[model samples]
Target: MYYSRKRLMDDLPEEVTAIWSCTNEKCNGWMRDNFVLSARPTCVQCNSFMEKGEKLLPVLENANHKQSK
Candidate 1:
């Protein structure tokens, strides 16, 4: 009887930056540069290996670490 609402989330700002993309064909996974682990970063979606790539994405940050300057 009613139409569905579009765009549920807020319009987050995005920019071009380096990221890791899932290598799996059936999976769509990606992580920000400042969010991946240095030792061995892996895709959390399908547990597959990720490759470095550049894409236009929203700026991401680690909420766990306190910003102390």
Candidate 2:
């Protein structure tokens, strides 16, 4: 017997969210602003300085994440 699988399409809409992007041109690292624990977060992948930017991404919430004082 042969079985067929169906592909599902994501219906969530994308929203503009604040993010931190790596300053290094060679590195393509970024993180959501709401998830950042530090006031000034560095790139976790390349250890480079990060700058504020915006991106169109799916809605996400970090209810458990706490900010460092």
> What lDDT does the true structure give each of the candidates?
0.75, 0.87
Candidate with top lDDT is: 2
Give the per-residue lDDT of model 2 (tens digit) for 1-69.
664443212665679999999999999999999988888999999999999999999888888676552
What lDDT does candidate 2 reach at residue 59?
86
* Each prediction's RMSD to truth: 5.1, 3.7
> lDDT by residue for model 1 over 1-69, one digit each (tens)?
664444423466778988888999999998876677664578898999889899987667678534331
Q: What is the TM-score of each candidate against the true structure?
A: 0.61, 0.80
Which residue pairs in candidate 2 collide?
Answer: none
Global CA lDDT computed for model 1: 0.75
Among these predicted structures, which one has the highest TM-score? Answer: 2
